[model samples]
Target: MDIKNLSLNPNYNILVTGGAGFIGSNLCEAILKNGNSVRCLDNYATGKPENIAPLLENPSFEFIEGDIRNAEDCLKACKGMDYVLHQAALGSVPRSINDPFTSNEVNVSGFLNMLIAARDAGVKRFVYAASSSTYGDSKNMPKVEDIIGKPLSPYAITKYVNELYADVFAKTYGMETIGLRYFNVFGRKQDPNGAYAAVIPKFVMHLMKHESPTINGDGSFSRDFTYIDNVIEMNVRSITGKNPDAVNTVYNVAYGERTSLNELVELLKEYLGEYDSKISNVEIVYGPERKGDVPHSLASIDKAKSLLGYSPSYDIKRGLKQAVDWYWKNLQ
Candidate 1:
């Protein structure tokens, strides 16, 4: 998972939109580790300043406080960049359900702004973060790239539109683009507080306080829980990989396995119990099934492997252990 060994251009100047967020900040950190320059653009709407505070003094790191929804800001951020890692978006199914207009504005319209800016700036490649929610109602156990069902939520629709836009930009503008459909990515620096917080980090924070962590369904719902390091490696490969066929296409970024919600809670308890013995006594609550939720989601990463040479370095257990240790050290 060490991206410093990747074949990145030494003189590369990469622009990472939403670079104050979890995955975006990690991309900035990884690129800087490879001795490349990175320009970070974020408005701190969902991204925290503390995430990138330590990187402020690095000579290779540059931060721009801007919003992607503004076309002018997008143009300014895209300036002087060899590559663009576009990760700026408003993410959450329930949040989109409540406010579809804003979701469409940021995820869809804002995405278009970034693409136009990247194309106009003559950026080499555009690597973006797509989501597994695009699979929608597809009952396929392992989701492949070519097959997808109709989108179920505003968030899913926005992501699907992003893929469509990327494809159109590639064909019409001759822009090189890669879309990674991430499957439940989790790890360090992921926000555990928020009304729309992800299940893993929210559950960890709750369990730390010896509180009951709620499961949205009957605990049978499963996900292809990918680790952050694995995600970072795939992104780096998408940019540095020399294969021509890999460009202008989408790939699933996952560990190629699924874990049920019930099993996930148990594993978290086991890991956290070692740090505080009382954590094992915390309970789990089962709530009603949520809207726009699929019963199961597992990704077939064969396309990524065959094309980009993707090899996941961490399974769920190993990743959870690392995350638990990090939370215990930093967030406790």
Candidate 2:
């Protein structure tokens, strides 16, 4: 990240909730590289310790091992921070379907806790992770931020409530907040070993092992599989943006293109095959469509482009190659 190009101050203090997780840890690394002070708050519930282990060596990075569910932890994490990047949330649709209580407790209540803490700490801006699932059951291709449909799952409800709370907080308390609705963000450091692991990383790991990965529906289900660098750029831009119009609203952080599961698998095989030719012959299995899963997800990134000047450098093919390389070197 070019601090000068982004117009970011090198001395700003930033707090990243869930800093031990995939997205948050990546944010910490980028911010620290830009010469900013970073404090991370995470309980390691879903966050992995290995993701953040290397960051501990950095003098500018601080990790607070605490849960967002605890108000005191949230308060401590928010104090003395210029901006808050709240990325802490329980993040699986299937997991939420099986365990709504835990999902609500963390995604919704914990999110509220972070908001109150940031408000009290007088943080300049609070940028949080919203979800594409918030556009539930809406058949609109290239989903615009303003035209959201009803939520399809409990996890979706929590993320949607975040936008609502952010708006209300801005109006009532005069807080500067921005919500980024990420669409299927995947890249290095994303876990592929969980029951609710995201498709990209999970499939990558399986393909590396020469195992068949199951696609939920007929290979037609598609997603706007965003890269992690793009997501990191959005978080940084949200904090530093000078536009008042961009401060209070939500923007879709995506590549603005959709890739079907079949295309995604083929791309993964093609990329990984460069390392191991045998991977090219791996078969993909089909199964029942996932409950609460959308048929297609494609975002219109015009709002992010116009508002924050977000220009995503890596599309799926470009980003997937990097991701595959990382997994091959690290996980294999």
Candidate 3:
């Protein structure tokens, strides 16, 4: 679906926390182009200033360098903002496992700070990034919003807590809140060089350099990899959607199909190979599955479709091809 179809009022003030990160920065760019004033709040804990560097030139864009862990910072960012898209948090399960305290501080406590700030600021709606990890150990094939399993890691716990806090605040204060539970999101501007980089970008980089990409646990694990534009559409709907049923709920933001690790590698190689045929000749390696790894994950985006009118335009192959092209042009 064309993003311009969402059609939020041009003059409304929107605040996107973590607006210097991959998904958040994309949202900022889309919102600004739609003629809205955008305020970006980021401490750069995991976000990059470079992601939003090009965005700084827009007079309608405002950048606030601050941490969400500070309640005062949260309050200042929310003040006068009509809508709040809270995306600031330390992502990655391994990173959370390595440091749970900091993860809890930012994802949990910091989320609370944003909630309070948005509530007090009288923001019309609070749309935040939730996670598929919240499904945890459920073993369900197509994860639905109502059913969930116990959290498997610190990151999962924090994301789940965000849902609970958002629900409570909505009930207690009569605030409008929506959560988008993202599933394996990837696209341009996703950092490919990190100890906890996402598999798609990391593997793309590995193959681009003619290096072997390792698969964890025999390459059978799977995920519902959604594209950035799809995620951007959902965030826009959460703010502009007028349905009362869509408010005060969480919807899975995904393409609704699972791709195995083996298939994922093959697809990336095929797409990247178009740029450098030698990448197709790259070797594959195997390793023991890391801790906190789920065997497979898929989401039921029915709720998003029925309520939020979400229509994801890209599947794995299409999104991967676009991503590979971006990495070749920008990163290589």
| Tens digit per residue, CA lDDT, model 1, 15-80 | 999999988888888788888899999999889899899889999999999999999999999988
Worst 10 residues of 2 by lDDT: 1-10
The count of residue-pair clashes in candidate 2 stands at 0
Clashes (N, CA, C under 3 Å) per candidate: 0, 0, 0
**Which residue pairs in model 1 clash with each other?**
none
* TM-score per candidate, chains pooled: 0.99, 0.99, 0.99
Instruction: Estimate, for each residue in 279-323, the C-alpha lDDT of model 3 and write its tens digit.
Output: 999999999999998899999999999998988999998899889
Error of 3 at 208 (Å): 0.7
Task: Let me know the TM-score candidate 3 reaches against the reference structure.
Answer: 0.99
Please report how far candidate 2 places residue 79 from its true position, in Å.
0.7
- State, as a TM-score between 0 and 1, how close model 1 is to the true structure: 0.99
What is the alpha-carbon lDDT of model 2 when measured against the actual structure? 0.93
Error at 157, model 3, angstroms = 0.5
Q: Best candidate, lDDT-wise?
A: 3
